[model samples]
Target: MRRRLIIVLCLAVVLVVAARLVMVTRDLPAQLTGAHFEGLRPEPNRLRAFLHRMPKGGDLHTHLSGAVYAERLIAWAIADGLCLDPAAMVILSPPANAPAERPCGDEAKVVPIADAVAGWRGQTTYDLLVDALSMRWFLPTPAVPSGHDQFFSTFSKFNPATGGSDWQRTLARTAEMTVDQLRQYQAENVQYAEFMVTLLEGEDRRRLGEAIGSEREPKAMLAALEQSGITAVVTQKVEELRALVARVDEMRGCAADRTRPGCGVQFRYIAQVNRNGAPAEVFAQTAVAAALARAAPSIVAGLNYVGPEDYRAARQDYRTHMRWIGFLAADVPVALHAGELWLGLVPPPDLDFHIRDAIETASARRIGHGTAIGFERDMDGLLAEMKRRGVAVEIALTSSDVILGVRGRNHPIRTYLSAGVDVTLATDDAGVSRIDLTNEYVRAARDHGLGYGRLKRFAFAALEKSFLPAADKQQQEQKLQRAFAAFEQEVTDDLAWPDWLAAFARALLPRRG
Candidate 1:
């Protein structure tokens, strides 16, 4: 009889609390389902909702080489008939079946195409590594130096067949493949707020330096490509870029239901020019970026070259590259992939200047990675400048979490945040690094000991800090403001909170109950 009375008393209390919640909210969906989490470990569902509605902006610091996984690249290679050597672990050109010379790479690290495919089917470590390529956005460091090298070197293997592989056919095929993967990801809870694309292009210095028509050396090749028509080639590239960006945008924003409105996602472009390119090449590429920025609306951004960190040839051209960017960016808005260095991979001087030159000269409104900021001199002063200029720094949380631990509470991220330097989270090479923004967010919150408020603020910063235009960014800010107001009011107004929060706290400590 006593046990039955206790159960009835509990039921009555639950009903009274439910009634109180209805009275307070008037009629609204309960956001914080903390009541649902009765056990010791906190409820992550409420946390997930909080993150979902957090109004996170787009990811600005993304890379193409590391963005696409090696497995996908190898898959593309195998589809083209290229095979990987088991012992050497490098992808062969023209595939094994039937073709001419194509670029191959260092034998030691990467396996051949056929061996990889077989190993991949049997779930060998090679297959595991290849499978890991697409997952780079989420996973912890996968042999950082080796992975980085493998990622960059795989380019040579893909470049050759890419030309002979019926360029149009290959592009369309890749588009389909990209769409299919995004769909699969959606089914599995991968959320994308926005995507920015950077296409890689190499420039011809000697020819561009001489002038548009002066093909004095490598005359045969120059004659063939010129006959192929520069305007036509540029158009083709632009069209291909448009299609690819369209596909990515569509994929990222694809909804489960046609009738339902979904998240805000926009697509932007950046024309990447390598920092290590020859002056002539760099100048020409910059001109192309300016032109594209002028020509396309869906594409309103410019960038150039990606992996200068690996190019031993351009060690002395940092200032020259900055100057070239200045000339090119006189007509367009750009973001530079700057300061992504460490003590070992880049020389000391490079760590000092790459971040400095990008800001002082290149007119780069945004900087990707900027990991070496801790290593740069006068960093505090730089942070002040960044705060004053409102030049936001995009931090690759997925990548950084793997490498950076607490350099103290005032590590690079916290220092930037505390100093009022706008900091954003990014996934530099999601596919290769095997990580996504969500995982980055989770890790950042846990590792950095960040509160919900701080994480949401960072999400807000990431979007507004994007190199997107003033009008679009302003619109996004307003939308974010509305969302922020709602969240802020919820936290501040305890009465407005779900009755469970108040009831639970009250129950735990009541006055003369």
Candidate 2:
């Protein structure tokens, strides 16, 4: 009887020890990470943890047309019962303004994986239709057609494809896609936390009409666009985007149900107005974003104008446009794509002045594609001013980085980072670039050699540079700090559970599950 009793006791003790061992090993990564936050291991998973833990500030830069994922676009197209030509794999359009010929010819569209990859790049052209979009120009000669030209010219190609459609249903599908992106992004992020949610709306389309500058009925186009409820349309679009975010928050609840906080990561809208668009359109979208900012919470923030700054009217009235932006900046947050340039597009004087003008005149809160900052006139003076204003910059790795990837290493990210320019890495267009926020994170780690500490700092910088207002930002930043500190403390604590439990078992246990 005594021997049997001893065996039972021994077995119980062994089981208890085994349980403890399992718990410790299962959480080994977390424990190790907690214990040595600074000396964190170097690997993708470690990098992921750093990214996940870091409070992403915001993605202040993204273009709507390009921001749409290609897969979703294909799915949307397929759902709409849009047919494609087998030969070219481009979606056919109804004969509204087309010559009797079908856009995709009369064949079924194919998604050959190899071809899709190649076509996704500018290495080869797919059968995407060309229309006089607010963003693209039909070229008579190939003189101006470089990769840069083709790159900037795509919005015009596809924007018309979406025009005059049932935007509500379209938004419903878009919202669905956004939900997927949010999960995919929660699994990662883009533009970091800012989630630069772009919406193609009223002023931009009309501006496209204006840029086209045809005498062929501007009033009719404006009237039609207005009827389409583009402003109302975009506002609804914001809700759909919110739907995706809500699901992400839901997932957050599921993951960290107890003793955690809400994901206050934000979403900001840039009512994309093309530089090549009509002055009226730019002004209108700017107004829309400003209004939305006042009405919406930290969620709906700001306005921005995108496109190459080399258009005729844009250059002519560049200062005038800045003055308009300055006026709007009083109420609305502004981020502008300034100084995204190549050698021959603009004069040295123009490139020299654009970014500074974007800051001073347009009151850009953040600068997108400040790629030419090194070349701008009084560049140091401007840099000093930018730093003074705390105007963070977004380094779009996918699109702008390609300039560096192929030829000249055109991105100024390293320069910006070194100069204490508040910099965040972003995928400018995931669809166009075939990259995402995760990809950006991976790239930043590998290419830039950013470690966990720095990645955390960069993530923090994104939130700081976000368009979120002062008070909300302060509160969120504090929360982020508290979260980091709390986790760090829990992780690095040397006290074993036995000690903790003996002292405070009842205190630690939840009142209810």
Candidate 3:
């Protein structure tokens, strides 16, 4: 009877000890991570390394064309035998009547891209090309006087390489770009991405717009688009996108090894409708985007209106565009690039309505670069609506800082969070901005004084607020949770035993006999 009593007491003690250990283990990693974050605050490189390995759930605002580095674009241009305008730093197709060997003709100013990047002077030109193709070493100049101008101008400069006239080559380029971005995201520990790409371009898009003609009414326009065989086009495009993903898988060797970096990173597209285009063209693009999103929710996650929000056409027809989206994409998810504007970038009135209209009219699930939220007409009500609807705001720190000069306290990230609105970090144009997702997290920490817990919430919020289907999103969230567990445990292990603790433990041990 005494032995049984002792056994019961021992078992109770074990249970109590185990419970204590479990509680300690549950909170230990977070405590250690917070300490590590604070310790590494002064060390930018160490902080970046810490954040780089941390799992970022998703990059929901990336642009496929802008996500690629300039060096890769240059390589593609060389491979395609394209020309370079030295002074302009822009890629151009071969002159029509030029010989195959002399694609740029005998014009001294226009040299083959390969030739332009060769030798000593070529090295200098290559540097300039990289700068011209991105925001690297950018400063206000006579020709490109504003960061906004320099930022938007890069598309035209690199258009020849990315959007060539050859359909097959363009598709190949798109595939290559997708693979490149996937690899990049994997490297930065981004588990998922929703790349904004123009899937319906070239002849099909133009024809659809031409068919839409003067059909201003949404029902009539959608019917016109349907009668114009847009369904067939969407079908073909979906298959083409599937093939593109297959190509990406092949490129990443994902079929052979599921554990490959790019293989583990899942992605989907957000079809981009260029707001700078004519009204009919924009309407046609929006219609096709809506249809595509509905037809392939798994592949095409959603639709977003891209291009400069402050452009005359975009501003003038902003409300009309929202109305059109409201009608066409009633059931489809929308993530409009609203409120990317700033005070001087546009008139004050323009800022007041873009974000409001995006949510109230277009029913945007997310807002990309919502930098102008503070300038909206009903700021409090807008925040309330965003919070109530659970509409997330995608914040691209580097993009906002460089393009709109909005960063630090000027940024609306804190405001969004304070209002209970979901906020996620993204790389708007990582390549163009010369930043990765880690860079954004680092900025959030260093610039905004966010701790590890807040940053982790951002990571989780990215996946939670994504346009992914319920199952996919849940899977991604589970993956993110696993990643965080591993990451935190690793951090705890690294930080749990300091030099003093090790020394003390060694001192406490008995000497060898």
Model 1: residue 349 alpha-carbon error in angstroms: 2.8
For residues 1-513, write the lDDT of model 2, one tens digit per residue.
999999999999898767755654574533343234333334657655655544444455655446665555554554454443334334434434433344333332433223333435723333233221221233434653454555555454344233325454444544454445444444443223444443555444565435434332334534544555646744765676577446555555635653233233344455555556566665555555565566664556677766666767777767767876777557677778777765666776777788899988777888887877877887778888888888888777656644323223445766676667788766676655656665666666556655444555666777677777788778767766665565545544644666333323322222210
TM-score of each candidate?
0.69, 0.65, 0.91
Best by TM-score: 3
> What digit string (tens of lDDT, one per residue) describes model 1 on residues 1-513?
999999999999998877765544552322232221121115555555445444455566665444555656666766666655554344555323332343234434444455455643645645644644433333335553444455555445444333333455545544544454444334323323333333324333344443543332333323444554544545656787787767655655555444222323444556666556555454555555666676664564666446645367455766666776776565676677777666777668778777777887876777777777877789888878888878777777656434432233434777777788777777766765666556566656555656554666676786676656789778777766666566545644544445556434543321220
What is the TM-score of candidate 3?
0.91
Task: Write the residue-wise lDDT of candidate 3 on 217-257 in tens digits.
Answer: 88888889889999899889888878877787789898778
lDDT (0 to 1) per candidate: 0.56, 0.56, 0.87
Model 2: how far residue 16 lies from native, Å: 46
RMSD of 2: 13.5
TM-score attained by model 1: 0.69
The top-ranked prediction according to lDDT is 3
Clash pairs, model 3 backbone: none
Better of 1 and 3 by TM-score: 3
